[model samples]
Target: MLYFKHYAGALLLLVMVTGLISCRQEEPPLQKVLEVRNLSDLATTEYHITKIVKASDDKTWYKLGDRKILMSVEAVLKAGIDLSKLQPEDVIIDGKNITLNLPAPKLISLNLPPSGIKVEYQEIGALRDPFDNAARDALLAQAEKQIRRDIAATGIFTETENNTRTLITGFLQHAGYNNITIRFSPQTPLP
Candidate 1:
């Protein structure tokens, strides 16, 4: 009878210990995570320019004094934001609200269509050299420069900002986030 009593006490102690451990909640690890890397290509523009290239220097050298060539060029300009510049402190998750500071938009790529080049007129003097592939390429480079300048002047960055905000906001909403706040890096003024 005494042995049975000791056995019952041991069982009671075991049950109490198990119940205490089970009632205690485990604390989660202390860590801060704001991992987000979503690089997206957002905007594209097609540009066309008609430019006139005058070979005045060649005129002096080869008697091609009144040479004027007309060239037409078409190119594609792609712009987007690069998320690789995101920093750890740039993101904050608070309840249902997520605030993210995205990097500034940039011009991603420029491509001239294969069959979009047009050389309307190439006037060569009798004693001057013909307009070759090198000359055509140089003119096209000029057109490319002008196209890029025009694209910048037309506020491509603004369009990119709008598109990025819309895209990310929709994404976060779909993921069950109630509020989404996105801001771009401020532009630094040049001296």
Candidate 2:
């Protein structure tokens, strides 16, 4: 009786092992729909730019001498497309050949950290008062504005667009797309 019980137990364990071995995990289905919220503001490129801000208080007719301040400011610029702006009609997939009308690349953010701005040189006239915080801030603001205008000259926008295209193209290719054409759609600023 003992010998029969042992052989039955061994047989049961072998059957359980075979059943477990034959079971396979099912893979999740590939997602076809793109979620815009998940792809919002995908910053593809960043640039660190330094600008020299110099301003002279020479416009005053009664001021005795010119008071000049020179400052060095570093600005961080991030650029990318807002994929959340993508519309259903923007993407057209015809049997693995996909065409996407993506949002145009835009300047995502420009940050000038307070620590990155320094007053390098200042020439205060003997009769003139020193540069105050408000004056310094105004100079920095003007510099920031100029930097924003000059960002396009740095080629950051073009590089950001190219990087975004390469990333999306690779993603689509991996999703089984053979041919991909991407076009940038013009976006109007929201008031």
Candidate 3:
């Protein structure tokens, strides 16, 4: 009975030590919130002047000042926003000295055409597996590189690192995902 008690005490002590060690392990900080500038009605619309030439009458008929006035309305919307929500007669734009006529406006939203997550690892010293510090640095570098490439290829409106995060957050928000997290791990080599 005494032996059993000693064994139990040892096991309990081991478990306690393990629990304390695990409690000391710190978790990664949460991703920062990025601010996205809302699109205004004025900056999203424009007008162009085009010359309308008549070939049959051999004359150029201009509607306004020797050019045809063409109005265009463009709204830079977040991904998953319903384009059909905008009506033809909706007051889509109110630019300075330019009231856009939205006879039919085509909506365009910035979205990731194709995005992926990648992981890589770098060895520290002669260690077979990278330690947490090396792993974290590698993961961060990979994420930043992938994010920049994705943004450039997709032509998204990401002016800075914060903007890139904002673009991703906006996409997630539009997709109805309020709480999302991105993670990376060491890449496994194929046999």
Candidate 4:
């Protein structure tokens, strides 16, 4: 009777272990949410700026000498949306139609290469100062500002926005989406 009791206990334990092992089955892989964004710069503007500076102070008691400097500059400006600024709610998809809210176009960069800058003419009086490196750098900075203004006046943002919409719409269409709506955030100015 003692042998039978031990044998029965061992058999029960083995059967329970086998049952637990068979009950464990492989599960399907976990699904992750899809995130979409736009970070491509599609439009750019090249600007040529010319400025004449008379480096003279009017408040001087005596009629001081004048130094005239003429500068010509070529710069490039880029505008685009920053995808990192996107939020999950910015994208909406329903069946084959999709809507995306994009950020406003911003000045991505201002490139004024030294080779593109030229001093057209310079005239300095004997008693007046000459155009030094610091003065030239300041002039270049002013040229950059002028280029920005010119780009704005030309409606570069409008062009960029249109290009972005077209590009994104095409991309979505290729990805199996039929209807696409694109809108920009009004809070971000085109400056």
Candidate 5:
């Protein structure tokens, strides 16, 4: 009986040691390399239009060719994951003729500010019907008020001038604004 007990213990120890040794974790596989011959050749590749803002209208009130044309536009483009397979430095543009070159692309991702404030602006452009300086100021004030109210409704951030600016700056940064400076006073009184 004593000899059998000692052998059983030895066998259990041997099995555990062998099991641990054989159960090594495997390493992850490396990413595959993409083969891109010509970026222009891939002009037909679909691109996602993230945002578009128009700021222009036809202006022809005076004589022939005397009228002016205003233009305001902002657009964001994403090539999608298929383009990710290509080299990051490569550039692709489509028009009458496809243009391809190496251009550094700017990538930006923005998070909503903790304050729950939302802000947006239209692209600049000359307009026939323009707002007066005072009207523009009033518009800005209204916008600020709306932002404060929206944020307050969410109850996410304390109402303070510094916090508002911080939240706005953070949101802009997340939205891919490389150089962003938000300037505004707090609309809501601090709790």
Candidate 6:
């Protein structure tokens, strides 16, 4: 009788422990979604592009003669998704499978360092004065604008979106998710 009582107590204790463990609350999937949203900007692709800055004073009547300047400038373009746009509805969890709907990637930054600009060629007619600092600054500004306008044609946005998916997929897999599906919200118009 003593042996049976001891075994019964052990069995009861084991059952209680198992029940507590099974009943323990698992973190809701929405919590994980918020965690991802906190990641903010996720820059996935960068492009080092060189642009030509050319200007001529021949068109201006105030100029005595033709004055031209040509310059080369390198720009850094970065594109990525802004995770802060993620909503709870964007994340769908089914058992081990998870589907994350993310906003489409956009231009994160465009850097045109002064050090990246170089004078390639200059021509000042004998009757014309050399290009001033203001002229050079204006030329650089025009070049920057052109680069921004041409970004969409370079296909960087598409590449950025692909890289973002690959990155988030690996991250979710590491978080113990088995089947992962990453979908992007409709892309916003490009600048």
For 1-191, candidate 2 gives per-residue lDDT tens digits of: 99999999999999998888778653322235366437899999999999999989878999998799999999999999988877777888787788888887898899999989998999988899999999888988998889877777888877988999999998888878999998986644422
RMSD after CA superposition, every candidate: 9.0, 6.1, 27.1, 10.9, 20.0, 4.0
- List TM-score per model, in order: 0.68, 0.77, 0.19, 0.69, 0.18, 0.84
| Residues 1-191 of candidate 6: C-alpha lDDT, one tens digit per residue | 99999999999999999999889987886686569778899999999999998887788887678888899999999999999999888888998999999998889999998889999999899898898998888888898899988888888988998999999999888888999999887766665
The alpha-carbon deviation from the true structure for residue 120 of candidate 5, after best TM-score superposition, in angstroms, is: 17
Quantify all predictions' global Cα lDDT against the true fold. Answer: 0.67, 0.84, 0.32, 0.68, 0.34, 0.89
Tens digits of per-residue lDDT, candidate 4, 1-191, equal 99999999999999999998889873321111123343344343333444343343434567467677877776766677665566667777777777788878777777887787788888777787788999988888877766666666767678778877887787778777888899998735335
lDDT tens digits by residue: candidate 3, 22-92: 98965322111111112222123222212111112113353222211121212223322222232333222
**Model 4 CA lDDT for position 136:** 88
Worst 10 residues of 1 by lDDT: 27-36
**After TM-score superposition, what is the CA distance of residue 116 in candidate 6 from its true location, in Å?**
1.3
lDDT, candidate 5, equals: 0.34
Candidate 3: 10-residue stretch with minimal lDDT: 49-58
Local accuracy of candidate 1 as per-residue lDDT tens digits, 82-182: 76677777777787788889887777777887577777777766755777888778888877776666665657677778887887788778766787899
Q: Report the CA-based lDDT of candidate 3 relative to the real structure.
A: 0.32
At residue 82, give the lDDT of candidate 5. Answer: 23
Off by over 4 Å in 4: 1-64, 149-151
Q: How many residue pairs collide in each prediction?
A: 0, 0, 0, 0, 4, 0
For TM-score, the strongest prediction is: 6
